[model samples]
Structure formats: structure tokens, C-alpha cells
Target: MSFLQPIALLGIALAATPILIHLLNLMRHRRESWAAMMFLIKAKENSSRMSKIRRWLTLLFRTLAICALSILLSRPMASDESSLINFSNQKPEVLMLVIDRSSSMQKKFLGSSKTLLRRGLEEFEQFSKSWPESKLVVIETVFSETVILDEIETLFSREMEDFFGPTDSGGNLPFTINKGLNWLEDAEIGHVQILVISDQQESNWKIRENEQLIRNIKDKIDSKEGLWKLRFLKLESAEINNFSLVCKTYREETDKFHPTLLITGNQKNTQSLAVKINVNGKLSNLKCRFFPPSTTWTPAISLSDQPPKGWIKISLPEDSFSKDNDYFFTYGNQEMLKVGIACKDEHTRKFITAVCNLDPERIFLNETFSLKSKKLKENDLLMIQGFSSPEEDSQILKFIKAGGRVVNFPDFDGNNKPQTFQNWNAIESASKNDFFQISEWNRNQGIFANTANGRELALPYLKILQRKIPKEGETLAFYKDGESFFRRKTIGQGVVYSFSTLPNRDWSNLGEGFVLVPLLIRIFDESSESPALKLLECGESASLEYNELTPITGNPNQKPSVNAGIYKELGKFFAFNRKTSESQDEMLNQEEMKKTMSSNHILWSEARANSLSFERAEIWNLFLIIMLLFLLGEGLLGLPAANFSFGAKRQ
Candidate 1:
């Protein structure tokens, strides 16, 4: 607690204030002869007033002295930390860079030579050259518009690796920069710098917390005598039209593709663009279509030849973010999604097994399956002819949770004794109106638009006397009256699809249809969407990929990354397949939701919605200012009560 001045404590000698007043209670003066008495009384009154003034001055001086003393003891300070800590001389600063590859960055003002990121990186490189041994810590951002996870070596230096290309087409403009700055914890003072190279898109740059964190770090560095510089390399060019594809996916169960293609650009209206698709590197098809900007275009993609290879690519012949004009992904193979059915009983299991093919080894027969975490490997759709036992029911639920899928017929026949497992009783309906079916209208739909050898479905006739829908039932096949024939629901991650009618000739003849295999394959495809599946609808710009085998890679923790090529036809709107990731058993707490739902999940969804909204911090600051104003108003209101009442309002 060193102080600039220690002598200020001497002012405490004035603390005798009130004591001095009491010690010398002056005797009241008596008037003597006329003139002398009057003068003496007046002198005494003057002395009394003077003493009162001295007492107040003494009290004020003592208080001031105490405050000064505290100040002297406290040793109030401003830090030289920022500079002193930088004492140990260091080499050039290393920066981790994230450059923007948005189409806007590609706008050319002078000529083809300069684009946003190109220029920004150039400036960054130049800046680094000025410092000795200044290294790049880590740099990974889409350039030219493609998302690339740089090999670890790429973080070293250009001499260590040389990989440069335009970035992929999509990056949500707003960023989460915490991942960038967090790595520099306790680095050599002034030895590291975070250089995020971007064009400073207004949408991306306004994260106040990011700025505050940087400022705090700078302040701390200053206190430690360390050098901290927030160097901004603003890269900009004239904004231009940007048409990007946001999303694309295929529904295997339906043998269909539904892509939500988004286009954002200067041109708000629809424009004709050619979409080129290659199936497994083989040139497949090219079509011209009109796409409107800033809207989702659900497009249908079909192949006339062998179904587009698992790997598909879509390209827009033109767009600024050209590096990402196409994307590639392989859908689960139809063969991989089938379950070979081989059940025990003739009345229950045998009958259902015939409904769809499942192997004895792969079948969901008993409870031991999921204790091992082996979700029923419904490489294909599961076919359960008979109702499962208590053990089977529990296993089925676990399988569903583990991602096994099944389409089954629940037997509730009077002739066929229904199966009962603990909580669920499969009761057959004798009512003539009980049977529900998938009408011919649904069967004949042009669902396989792009498939060359696509299945032409024939309805299955399953009249198994079955139980009513469960509380968690899903009506996949419904009757005209809206009752379910096929009630599919999740038992966990596994899918439990039940049908009331049996599969054999005695029941409805649906099991012996040409479409049976195809329909079953479709179910498997639908269920496998449980992990890393992409969906796209009709009229949407979609890219198809056939990179590998069935069973899309299920890396739950590995970031689900989609590479949309230079155009909007590629992987877009890389939405993390949320349904697959969330726990089916985890219910959204409505009480918690209600607290937020008054504003319609405003804060919850507003974050991902990418909608333009006011910053909450600014709102809170305004609230603080309002509170301060209120206090100021209260203080002002009291001014009128004082002796110096603000000149009374003219009566």
C-alpha cells in the first residue's frame, strides 16, 4: 500500500470538532451601561456563530483526512503489467487464421487478380513477414468456398504443406470464435496473436462478447506488461450476387430424394441454371431449372439408369463460390438394410417371418441382442410375423434405441391367438371394419421418379387379427376410416412397425406381392436415416454422391460436415440430423419451455434461425441506463423538499 504522499494524516489534528464545542460553553453576556451592554451582547453572538463554523470545518477536514489516509494505505494502481511481462524478448507472433470464403468475398473490383480472401491472406502474409520467426498457429477455413479440415501438418507452414483451393459454398456467416481464442491460454506474453482473416461481413463481425473477451485479454496483458494487439485486417470488395445450395437428401425407403436448395444472391428473382449431376464419377444427367433466391427449393432427383451410385454430385455451372459447386455422399445400400426373417412358431413367428425376409442369425428373436448393444442389424427392413414375447419386446425397444428398424404384422386373430408380452396385449379385432390398408392411390404414386429399374409396388394383403394402436403408435398404413394397419413407432432407437393382418394366404395376401421386397427396402432406408442421413424433396437442387458402401458413417462425435461444392447443388444447410442425435426418451421439459415459449422459443431458436434481431447485450445496457435514469429522477425529485426548493412553481 505505497502512497504518493504520507503527510496527509496530519490533517487528523482537526478531529477535536464536537469536543471543542462542548468544552468552552461560553457564558451568556449581561448588559452593563446602555452602549457597552449592547456592544458586548453583539460580540458574543458573533463569536458563537464563528465557533459553529469552525466546528463544521473541523469535521469536514477530519473526514477528508480519513479518506486520504485510506487512499495512501490502499495504494490505488494502474498496471504496467502489459509492458513489464513482455520483458523477456520473444520472436514474431503466431496467428491462427480463419478466412471467409463467402461468394461476396469473390466480387472483383479491379480485375480477376483480387478477391476477398485472396487479398486478406496476402495482407496477413505480408504482416507476418515483418516479425521474426512469426509462425501460423493453426489455420482452417473454407477458401474459394469448400470446407477443408487441414491435415495437422498444414498448421506448420507453407513449406511444410501446400494446399490451397476455393472454399465450399456455405458457412453460416455468424461464427463461434471461442474455439479459436481458447487455444492461446497462457502463451508466451506477446508471443501469439489471433489473426482471423475475413472480409468483416457485418453479419459475422458483430459478436460483442468476442470483442469484450479480446479487450479483457488485452487489459490483462497490459497489467502484466505484455503486448496484446487486436489487429483487424478488413478485406472487402463490392458485394455481388450469391446463389448457394443450402441442403440436399434422399429418402431410401421411398426411393426418393428431397433436397431443400437455397439460393441467396443480389438477384432476388428466379434464374435459370443448369444442374449437372454425376453418379459415381459417371456423367449421368444435366437439367436446367429456375431457382428463386433466399428460398428453399425442394427438388426431386431420380436416375434413369442403375439407381444413382451411392456417391452423387451436383454442380451449378456458375456461381462465385465455385470451389463448392458440387457435393458427394452415398446413401445406404438397399441390400444392407434388409433383415432375414427366420422365426420359431408356425402360428406366430413362422407366419410373420414369411411377411419379409430375415436371416435367423440377424433376426430380432430374443432379448440378448441389445445387452450387447448390437442393435438389430436390420441391414434391410425387419419382418416380424408373430407378436414378440416379453423378452423380445424389451429387446425390440432396445434395438430401436440402438437403431434397428423393423416393419412387422402384429397377430390379433380369434383363429390366431394373439401374443401377449407384459404391458402390451395383441388383441385381434373381429369387427369387419377393423382391417386398415394402404390404398391403391398411395401405391400407384410416381414415387420412383428417377429410378430406371424402380419397383412397381403391388399391395400386400395382411388380415392378421391385431391389437389397437399403442399410445406411442405411428400410422404408416391407414384404412379409409383412418385406423392403422401398419403402426410404426420407436421402442428406443429401433423401429417397431406393426400390422394387424397376417402375411400368409389365410391372412391378407399383401406378403406375396411384387412390391413387398421394394417396400421393405424402403422401410430400412427410412429407419437408417437415424444416423447421418440427408433429405431433399421435389424441385430442389440436389447433389448425389456414391463414395463408399452402405451405412452412412455414424460418427456421432465427429462433426457432421457436408461439402457443398462451388454451386448450390452440393451439400448445403449441413443440418446436424437432430432427430438421430437427441435421446428419444428425453422429453422437452414443457415447464422450462413455457418460460421461454411466451415469446415463441425466441431466444432458443433465434440463435440457429439466423434471423436478424437486436443484440440482447444492448437491450440489457439500455435497461441499466433506464435504471440509472430512475435513480437520477428520484434524486432530482428530492431537490424540491430541501431549503433551496427549486423556485416554487408560479402559483
Candidate 2:
């Protein structure tokens, strides 16, 4: 037996109190053999012996009663075998049904047309009906509103059907359990029985230990004193084969927009798949093949010369689950890069102008401006040819905070001071003889990410005439003397790149090397667009910064709504769908789940097509009953023998 309140067992020492008292009573009496009245003494001794034996029996009963009471107060719970003990007299005080309405639950398995969620709910209904007096609380998902069932007949109604309807949102098992714990805390109930019905997908159930979410659940249940029983009814299928489509990206080639779709599945050999596109109220089909057992095939659809003016809907072949089969996309015209040069020096201006207006493939539209120019847009890249003071013009810092990138180059005019938010610090200038060579560099990131033949190509064999030591940020390129050559700092939505030396030959040989062209282009690209893709899961909220667009299918712009589809917001597009990781068919078995959850109060059952079951049974109340029986026995033993015989005829 496990004791919930092990500290209460210390009261068992009180059982020795009855034995000690009985011994003291015996000590108080003395055996005196007097010959004055022999017959009287003998008769008295016999009566005294009988009285002493009765007192001893009563003491034993009281001690046993005390021990039983201590055990009961300690809240002793029986071992695993106690589940076999039938407690039909006891009823669940709180019945909680936590259902998973993720997209994966809609998969129809063999031998049944109903979805996994449907079958699981039907099994729960059957079990709940057996205990008609149970108070039910339904939690569909972590995001779902908590519902209290008023009537038993309402379990299978149309309203409940919608509550358990299909959804494209993914499920977080730990978060759902936390919600249930919150409800259980406020509920004024006795014994709680929570039924969690889910497909038990590994992506959802395999909560990481470091997450602290599952830890909260374990701690809450452990502290409940075994008042609640958590049962997971894992629904499984016979065969697992699924396919999904992911909207990857949009690429414009030859002035035409093409939408790329990544088709992924676990088919055995090769399977033919259909790609459907609905545009201008006309439907078109394209065929593709999946070379399987885990293969990804990417196919692109080129739009016509006119392009799609309205929202476009693309769909793949329908499978058992259609939540992730469709995608939405809208094409906006290509945006141009705006560049602002803050350099007034004629020599520096000439170099910057030559780089910005390079050829027929010209990308950046350049304009000359001061640091306080009103023409500077938030998205424009402000390239300062010489060092600028953040204190001289507060507008420079304000422009950066408003989503503007700054590229600062050293002018060596002795007016240089470290910016407030920039990570680097200004130190003593390098000596003339102490020229530093390239030591370390982060070639795989930032501006040098795609440098051609980066590993084989050697950096310019040049020495810095003067440079400053960087105090922070990633050292993209370092000098042999432990000074940073180039550093990148991220502040809010914008970035600042600091070069240790000037761009001209007088300070460094970087401009004469192959790094200049790609460096400028990468900076322009970073300024024009965000590098991160805005892929979202269903039911997630859009950020306030992005311009919300209306979906074509429904009025998704309604207040307080979570709808899934493609959306074009401001400079980027959002492709929201079910998380691709949740599509894996892997699941945790019963034993595996027990170890993962690490809670003794948890019970698990696999409610297959035939039967439903509950595993763990509580035995705390049984200990209480045993204690009461012991008390009754002590009461009967404490009564005198003459009192019991008074009811009978006097003999």
C-alpha cells in the first residue's frame, strides 16, 4: 500500500498508549494472600481474575482500532492488483472528456466508416451512460471552450457533433492537460475521472521533458492526493498511409509567377496523384507521381500571361484526410528595392553609384540623402559612407527602429564614436606596422553565405592600415590580431552591419576583391524583403504588423475567428495549414506512454472496435470503511458481560 499522507502514520505510535495504560492499571493492584477469610478471598480472586482478563481484551480492541484509524487517516492506497476490487457503490464525482479534434483524427481506418474521433466519442458515450449520474465536462482541444453537459441525451446531438467536428489545427497534449487541470482545480467535486480520447500521435503526445508544460501536469496530478483518475483512450488504425501538400514558395521567372507545391507521402512504390487548380471559375487537372515509402516531389504551376488577379486555390488528390490537401496563394506585383546613400564624399559617392546602377539586371533604385532626410522610407537601406553619430541626429536611430537597415563604413575622420544600440565598441586605432590578416570568419552566414567557391577562394592578401575592435555581435570576419573585420547586429526588425575599415584601398583591399558585389546585393536583398517564411498552423492569430487580407472561401475577417487558408499580408504571404510534423503515423504504445507521462495516477486503455475499458481503481475509501468496522468492534468489546446478558432471562 502507498500512503498519500505518510506523515499521518506517526499517529500509530498512539496504539502503544492503550497497552501502557493497561499495564499501569495492573501495577496499581497487589495480590495479598490473607487467611482471615479464606473462602471469601478465593471468591474475590476469581472475580478479580475475570475482570482483569476482560480489561485486557478491551485494551487489545482499542489498540487495534487506533492503528486502523491511523492507517485510514494516512490515506493508504492499495497496490496495482486493487483494480480488481469492485467499487460499484462509488461513483465518479467529476467526469471530464478531453477530446482531440486535430486533422489526423479524421482518418478513416479499416472496418469502419466513422472517423477515429467519432468512434472514440461513441465509446465514451457508452461508458458515461453506464454511470447516468456523472457530471460531464467536455474539452475538445486546448483552444476549445470548456463545456458542461446538462443532459445525458445531449451527448450525441447535432450541436455536440459540431463540437467534435474536423479541424486543420494541430494539438498540443501538454497544453490540453494544463487546461483540464485548471478546470479540475475550480471544480467542487469528490472523485474525478478524466477520459482523454485521442489518436495519440507521437508528434502530439511525445512531450519533451524540458518543455515544463508536461511537468506542470505531472506536478498537479501528483499533488491531487489520488482524487482524480486520468484515462487515455488511444484510438488506432490497422494500416497507416497518408499524403499531404505543402505550399512552399513563389518564384517569378521570365516575368511569370509560378507556385511551387511540395507533395509528400509514404506510398510503397510509385503512385499517380492529381493536381487540381481552380481559376476564373474553370478547373484544370495535372498528373504527378510519388516515388514512395517517404518521398517528396515538388511541382510548380506557371500562371498565364495575365496572371491571377484574384485569390487562387490549388488542391491535390483527396485522401482519407483532406485538411492539408488544399493550398491558397495570391500574386502581387514584384516590388522594387529603394536605396538611400548618406555619403557626401565625391569619391565614396562615385563607388556607391557605380555599384547601385550596375546593368540591365539593375535592382536597387538609389537616392542621395543626409542622415536626417525626410525622403528616407522605413524599408529603405541607408548606407552611410562615413561614420555617423547617433547623438547628432536622433532620426537615424528612429529610422532604424522603424524597420530600416544601416550599413556603416569607417571614414577614419576622428569623429567616430560607438552607436548606442550597436554591439561594437571603439578602441585605439591599430599601429602602422601592425597590419592584421584574416583570421576567422562566419562564411556560412550573413553576406558571405553564397560566396562563389568560398572554401577554395582565398580572401584578399591585404592588411588593414587601421581598424577597431568589436565588443559584441557575431564576428563574421576577424583579423589575425583578434580584431573583428566585419560584424552584424540585429536590433528590433532591422540590422546594422559594421565594417572595421573603410571600403577604399587606403584602409582595406575588400572593395578590390570579389566580396564587394555579393555584399552589396545581399544587403539590398535583406532590406527589400524578410528572409523568414510566414508559415502558420491553423487557428493561429496573424500579427498586427501584417495587413490582413480577406480569404476567398468565407468571411474569415470576422472578429474573433480562426480560419485556415492562404492569405497575402503586406510584403509577404501566409500559407497556414496543419503542422506537417503532426502528419507522421507513428504512435506511442501503452507501456511507452506510461513511462513518458511519469505519473502513477494515469490510466491507459486502447478502446478498439470491440470493447471499451477503464484500468485503474481507487481504494482509499475502503481503508476508511475498515477503520469504522474496527471502531465498532472496539465498542462492542468495551461493554460489560452483565449488560449483554441483561436482555436474556436471569439464570
Candidate 3:
């Protein structure tokens, strides 16, 4: 048996008090000699044994009463085996179901046909039957909205299908739980049972990064000791052989279209796989070999003489997880990428202009302009090298909100006045005879990612003599001394990149054009009109303010936020896919889970795919009844017994 308040068990020491008092009373009796007293004592000797028996029984009952009271106060819980008889009495007044409908939950166990999500729903449906009077409320991951159900049967009805249906989005377990707690606090429900059904994927939990959130949740649960109970129905599978595909980026040439794909799986050996390609409804297949530990693959598709604006679908062989097996992408005709340069230093401006104009085909429309001019909205990307005035800062912000990317270089004029967009610390330079070298970066993604053919960038070869540090943002690349080389901040829909060093001979060798050219080109491509709208993570498309969106692929009636598909709004096409984190194979182990949810009020249990039994129940009422019964027995034994004669009555 477990306890909600184990400190109350210290009261069990009171049980020995009764026995100690009985021993003291016996020792207090002194021997007395008298003719009359001796005769009376002899007459009652036969009944002395029976009186002694009743006295001992009274003491035993008193001790048991104290023991039961202690156990009752501790709030003991019984396991399934012991709680079978008391299951009906364990109904809670409020039942809040926090379900994780992330993409990973769609995976099925090895050799099992039912998905983890389906198993969770079935388990909850069966358990809710035992609490027929509970007020059911659900919080799903996709929307994280508090849904009040009229009855438990409504959970399975067609009207509530959207809440329980599959979703390609990743789950925010902490945020969803917080939302449920907020609703419960507003409703002022006393007795609540929060049942969280999830696969315990680490990406969904994010235990380390969300320390503050977890602390707040723990404090809230601790404040309401007996009023709330938290339980987890973890549906964990043993096998980890799932294959996931991700479309990192796509390129279009004269007669061929290349789509860069990332394939990640848990298998440890090399294997051959077949990928199905669907280009505007025409189906074909390609054979590829997968090597363990290597996850990059680039495939080229032959394009016909059709219009460049179309959609492509890539599908892998069905594996343990079906949701991540397919990837959707939409392509469009290439347009000239416009770039605006606002640099105070002549050398910095010339270097950047040269790199932007390196493409011989004139794919880039590079223009030198001042930030004071109100022509920022037309450009796809803006490169600023120095501080700007208040008016220019406001215009830059508005441009960023309208989906314009910006790259900020350090100010060489020592003008450190605060700007509205971002703040930077004083410039720091390397010591004499020493230089700062790039030590680490995210090579799998972002501007400095590997080439389409899986070649690393030349960031490590660069040496930095001077740098500036941003006050706040995510560090994309780090120097040898743990300083940030590149930082990124996402403002609205656009991103701002901050480079610590300038692309000049004085600051670093970034002007060598190997790293600078590709970096600028990737950033320029990302700022295009179609790339951002063409591919998006699930749940992001729902936030768009588009008035009308027609389905181009998948179910026409389904919401884009809940499923992966392609849609068209106005004249632009958008493709929604599951978040890449959902494809990760890391799961929370038992130790980590215990550390994350460390509270007496919370209880977690592992569940098999087909198990339907409730694992735990609070049996404090059983101890309460036991304590009352023991007290009643003690009272009865303390009462005086009536004297009786077997043969004759004394008159």
C-alpha cells in the first residue's frame, strides 16, 4: 500500500500508550492486609480471571483503534488486486482526461494492429464506466482546449470525433496539463482525477527544458493534497524499428527536380528500401540503399515539359509508424530573389554585394539602400551592418513581421545606442597572438547545414579576431571559448540572424567566399515568397489568416492543422507535415519519469497494449471504517458487565 501523507503514520506510536497505561495501573496496586478485605478477595478470586480477560480485551481494542486512525490519516492507496472490492467507492467527482494525440502516438506495437492512441481511448472508455457520475472534461494536444462533455458516452460520439481523432502535430504535454489545471481551478472542483494517457516520448515531455513549468505544476498539485490525484497511463512499446522520412529542402533545375530527404530509423544494419514517387498523379518507384548511422539521402526526379508549379508526394514503405512514412512538397517557378544591403562600412557593403551578385544568371537582385528609405517591404532579405534610427528600426520590425529576413552585422563605428529591434554588448576582441575559431554548429539544419550531397560547411576553417554578442537569442554556432558566433531570433513569421564577426579581412576570413557565399545564398533562398508557404509544420497552417483554402491533397473536409496535406489559398500552395521532433525515438525511462513527476499526489503506472484494468484506487475510507469499528469495540469492552448466577439469584 502507498500513502498520500506518510507523515501521519507517526501517530501509530500512540497505540503503545494504551498498553503502557495498563501496565502502570497494575503496578500502582499495593498489597493490603485486613480480615474483611482478605475474605472478600477470596470470594471474588474465581471471577478475577474473567475480569482480567475483559480488561486485556479492552486494551487490545484501544491499541487497534489508534493504529487504524493513523492509517486512515495517512490516506492509504490500494493496488488493483486489493482494491477490487472497493473499486466502486473510488469514483471521483471530476475526471479530466489529458490525451496526447501527437504523431508518435499513431505507432502500433510489434505484431499488434491497434495503435497506441486507440488503446488509450479504449482504456479510458472502459475506466469511465466505473465513474458514471463524474463530470468529464478533455484536453487534447492538437488544440489544448478544455472540452466539457455532457456524458462519458459523448467521448465516443461522432460530434466529438475531432477531439479524439489522429493528429500529425507534436504534443505539448506540459502546456496541455497546465490548461486543464486552469479550467479545474476556475470550476472550483474539489475531487479531481487527472488521467494522462501518453506514450511518454521525451520530445513531448521535454522535462529538462521545462523545469519552471514542471515546478509550477508540482506546486499546484501539492497544494491540493487529497482534492486531486494525477495518474499516467503510459502506452510504451518495446520494439523500435520505425522509419521516418523528412523533406529538408527541394531544388528545381531545367529538366530535373531534386528533393533532399532525411531518413532516420532505429534499425542497426544496412538495408535496401524502395521509395514511391508521385508527381502530379503519375506514380513511379525508385530503389535506394540505407546505411545505419547515416541519415541523408538526395534523390532526383525527371520532370516533363509541364508547368513548374505543381505538387510532389514521396512515400516510404509502411513501417511501425505510418504517419511519418509520407512527405508532401509543392514546387513553383523560380523568381529573382531581391536583397537589400544597408551597411555603413564601405568594405563590408562591397563584400556582401559581391557575394549576392556572384550568380552569373542574375538570380539575385542586389541593391544598396539606406534603412531610412521606406522601400523595405519590397525586398525579400535585408542585411544591416550598423545601428539604425528609431524610425528605421520601426520600419525594419514591420518588414520582419511581413516575412522579410534580416542579417545583422556588428557596428564598426562604436555607436552603441540602444535599438528597438535588438541590443548587443560591447565588442570583444581576441587576445594578441590568439584567434577565436568556430567549434560547434548545427550541421543538420539551418543556413550552415550540409550541402545537398552531404558535405560539411567550411565554418571550422575560419578564424575570428573580433566579435559582438547578442543580449538574447538562440546561439546557432559557438566559438572555442563558448561564445556565440551566430545567433538567431524569430520575430513574428520572419527570422533575424546576428553574426558576431564581419565578412572582412580585419574581422575574419569570412570574405573568402566559400562559407559566405553559400550562407548568403541559403538565407536568400529561404526569404523567397513560396518556400515559407510551401512547406510548414502541422498546426502552423491553422493560424494563417487566409479567407479560403481549397484542398489539393488528402481529405478535403479535414483541418490542415490536424493532418498532413497540401492546400491552395488564392494562387499559392502550402504543404503541411508533422514536426521533425515527433520522429525521434527517445522515450522517458522510469527513473526520469519519477524525477520529473515527484509528488505524493501523483501516481504513474505502465500499461500493456491490451490491458484495461485500473491500476490504483484510494482506500482511505476502508481505514476510516476500521478505525470506527475498533473504537466501538473498545467502548463496549469498557462498559461494566452485569452480574449473574447460574443456579440461583442472590436476593
User: Using alpha carbons, what is the TM-score of model 2?
Assistant: 0.52
Per-residue lDDT for 642 in model 3?
79
Query: Residue by residue across 1-651, what tens digits does model 1's lDDT show?
Result: 112333543544544543465456543454356767667776578556765665555544444444444344433222211121353434435544555444344445323346655555555553443342455654333211222233323333544222232322233222323434444444543555445555444423322213454344444434433333334344434444445443322443335555544433456567677677665446645454554434434556654444433555566667654533444445433233335453432654554444334544223334222322434553434555544556665665555556566655544433233333112334545545565455522321122111222233444344433344432354445554444555555443345656555544445555554544455545544554433343322111221221222222232222222222111114422222211111111222334433522231011221111211111111223324444554455344334322322346553
Cα lDDT tens digits, model 2, 48-123, are 7887777677777788778878877877654332332554335677688888877778777435778887787776
List model 3 lDDT by residue over 1-651, tens digit each: 556788999999999999999899989999877778877887799789888898888889899989989988988877552353554444578888999988888877434677778778777775665455688888988788988888777766776766787888887798789888888899888888888989989878755445667777878888997578888888875475678897667787876788889887778999998999988778999987888765778888877864667777899898756788889877764677778889987888988888776774635655546687798977878889887888999999999777778888889766777566678888777864788898887676677778866889998888778777775556778888777788877677777888888887788888887788888877766766543464677754233333246778787676577778777776777777887778777787767667866888888886654446564567889888888898898788888887876657554
Clashes of each: 94, 0, 0
In candidate 3, the residue pairs with backbone N, CA or C atoms under 3 Å apart (3 or more residues apart, or in different chains) clash, namely none
Better of 1 and 3 by TM-score: 3
Question: Model-by-model lDDT, in order?
Answer: 0.41, 0.63, 0.77
Q: Report the C-alpha displacement of residue 466, candidate 1, in angstroms.
A: 36
Q: What is the total number of backbone clashes in candidate 3? A: 0
C-alpha RMSD for every candidate: 16.9, 11.9, 8.6
Superposed model 1: Cα runs more than 4 Å off: 1-112, 133-138, 141-165, 169-183, 186-191, 200-226, 252-260, 268-270, 280-291, 294-302, 327-651
TM-score for candidate 1: 0.37
The alpha-carbon lDDT assigned to residue 649 of candidate 2 equals 64
